[model samples]
Target chain A: MRTILILKRLITVFYYLIFIGLIAQLFRIINQIITGKIHDLKPKIFGEQLDYGTMSLFEIGLSGVVPVVLFYCFFQSLIYLKRSLKDLESGNYFSALVITNFKKIGILFLVCSLGEVIGKLLFFIVFKSKFHFELDSSVVLFFIMGLFFMFLSEVFQKARRLQQENELTI
Target chain B: MLAKREMKSKELAEIIGITTANLSILKSGKAKAVRFSTLEAICKALDCQPSDILEYKED
Candidate 1:
């Protein structure tokens, strides 16, 4: 019980940090453009720079709309996570529920992740970046993985709902 | 896999200010989402815990 509580707190911290970090990455890129420096400023993971191709249609689509959509998705996921954890702590896991919207988001992520892999391979072939592009397929993959995690949580939520309904009818 | 359960899906709906269809959706687990306040009203009308309306399985 104590361990779960600690873990929940840790999860909250991770959520906050990742959100802030993503925002900071965007900020740095915007700032660099304002100052007119050619130095790369895109976010990095595991010491390797990622490529975000300017000519990639996938990236162009993601730029104006994908960021907002991804952020909305992540926010909705966090809400569900918050509810599930609360239910768990209350020993109400049997009553918790997950909506179908979450599942759709999960599948969306899965598709996007695959798309990103294709994007990465294509970019490499085209020599889109000498160092790395502004948008990395890796981050897109991470977003998709996050959706996968949410999908799993939704499964648990459905299980809980089923349990609660059974108890009522019997 | 076992016997199906019954829900006052309509009676509860009328009291809770939801349409019969919405209540049915929730009762049938076809609902995309549920409001907390609606859940609370359903619990009250049905005179049961939320668990009474939801169940768990091991698979």
Candidate 2:
């Protein structure tokens, strides 16, 4: 329980960090745009080499949609993780909330991680390059972690059923 | 057995050191399983054999 509390605090800090990082990134892009230094912005701002001077605001905005969706999925997963940790700290081992949160976290992890692959595929398709599906180690790790959490949700479901049976037995 | 012994469900629960809710569960056949100690206590309190109160049915 104490470890869970510590982890909860850590996740809370990480959550804030991710939020701040996104804000900083947004501010940096806006600052660069305002200063007419759009060329100085990161090359892969939208998972591609965006030609700022040649592209309209709407085109740039459209490019941001994928990143926004990935960020949302990651953020929602973190929220569910925090909730699951809170439930565990409260001694809700096999509760429905924990199970659902774990499942949601798993799904979000998969979805957000898959965004990278989709971005790579778009790069290949747009450039008419060779089809090289190179899997990054971190992406594979996240994918496995997602699957593990999904397995954990099923385990908890079974445990909850057993707990109910035990409780009903006199 | 409770009626023959002129005892209420609440009285039986109290005598057997269990909650009335649990006693109600036992009576309604909603309980998954009964402990031997609880069954023995019930039988002793009602002055009856386990066979007198327990029935087996195929599901």
Candidate 3:
């Protein structure tokens, strides 16, 4: 219980830090764009940096959108994580809300990671570019973590059913 | 069973040392299981056997 409290505090700190860092980075990029020094920035999408000069406006917009979407997914997962941790601290392991949140977190992770892969595939197909199948370790980790959360939600669901049955047995 | 035994649900619930809500749950067939002690209490209060109250049906 003490450990969970400590962990929750740590997560809260990290959550704020990440949020601030992302926002700061966004402002810095905007500042640079306004200053007309965009060439100095090497922005990456799905871990690969693209040549902005050669790419069309649509491609640049798509690249920019993907990172923002991924960040949103990450933030959402963190929010759910914080909520689940709070529930755990309150000894609410089998709550429906926590279970649903876990499921949502898993889905968000899976969709974000898998969507990156699918987006890469589609980009390569549309552009008739050389298909280089490079699997980032982080993406694989996200996928596995997503599956684990999904499994956790299922286990919680079963435990909740047993608890209800036990409670009603009287 | 309470109707046949001329006992109110509240009266039976008090006699069994359980809440009326639980009694309602049992009456409404919403309870997942019944304990032996609870079954014994219900049978003793209603003056009936377990078999009289419990019935199996094919779903």
Candidate 4:
């Protein structure tokens, strides 16, 4: 229990850090757009520097959609994670709601990771750029962590059923 | 009946092989269900018939 409490606190701190990081990213993107930096598509692509430019407005718009969707999914997973941690802190370890939230977080992480891969493929096709495709370690880690949480959710569901049975047993 | 039989709750619980807390649950009518084995143990410990102790009431 003490370990869970400490872990919950650590997760809370990490959540705040991620939230701040996301805000900084948003601000940086806004600054870049305001300074016309977005017009030059020479930015980093899949962790590799690409010198491609001369993209159509529609292509740029489509490229922007991927990152936005990725961020939305990531943030949503974080929300579910926070809720699950809160439920744990409240001593509702076997709660069905917590299990549902864990499953949601897991699915969202999977969506984000898959979305990144698909987005990279779409970017390569639409932009007609010679980009090296390398799998991101962080995205892979997220995918594995998502699977772990999904497994944990199943374990919790079983434990919840046992708890209910114990409570009802005379 | 325990007072008439000179048996404490602890004694009854010990005879029935259950904790006092669980016996209290049965006594308080908070138990969801009781097994026949446990019911028989309780009846044997108290020296009573099932009809003497068990009563059904609708929720």
Which candidate ranks first by lDDT, i.e. highest? 3
Which CAPRI quality tier does the interface of model 1 achieve?
incorrect
TM-score of model 4's chain A: 0.80
Task: Report the C-alpha lDDT of model 3 over A56-161, residue by residue, as the tens digit.
Answer: 7686676677567777898999999998897899998899988999999999999878877777776565544668565788879989999999999999999999
Distance (Å) between predicted and true CA of A58, model 3? 3.9
Q: Model 2 over residues A1-170: C-alpha lDDT tens digits? A: 67888899999999999989989988998899898887555456433566756666675665667778888998999989987887798898899999999899888888877886786666555443557465888678879988999999999999999998888787
Return whichever of 1 and 3 wins on DockQ.
Answer: 3
RMSD of every candidate to native, in Å, equals: 13.5, 2.9, 3.5, 5.1
Minimum summed lDDT over a 10-residue window in model 1 chain A is located at: A38-47
- What would the TM-score be for candidate 3 when compared with the true structure? 0.78
Name the candidate that leads on DockQ: 2
In candidate 3, stretches whose alpha carbon ends up further than 4 angstroms from where it belongs are: A44-59, A118-130, B1-11, B51-59
What value does the lDDT take at residue A12 in candidate 4?
82
Q: Write model 4 residue lDDT over A59-132, tens digit each, in one string.
A: 66766688789888988887787778878988989998899998888888888888888888777766666564
CA shift at A169, candidate 1, in angstroms? 4.3
Q: Taking the candidates in order, what DockQ does each have? A: 0.04, 0.80, 0.67, 0.52
Give the alpha carbon lDDT tens digit for every residue of B1-59 in model 1. 11132545565668888787766676677655566788788777767788877775564
CA lDDT of A55 in candidate 1? 29
DockQ of 4: 0.52
* RMSD in Å for model 1: 13.5
Best by TM-score: 2
Q: Which has the better lDDT: candidate 3, or candidate 4?
A: 3
TM-score of each: 0.44, 0.84, 0.78, 0.71
Point out where model 2 deviates above 4 Å. A26-40, A43-51, A54-59, A127-132, B55-59
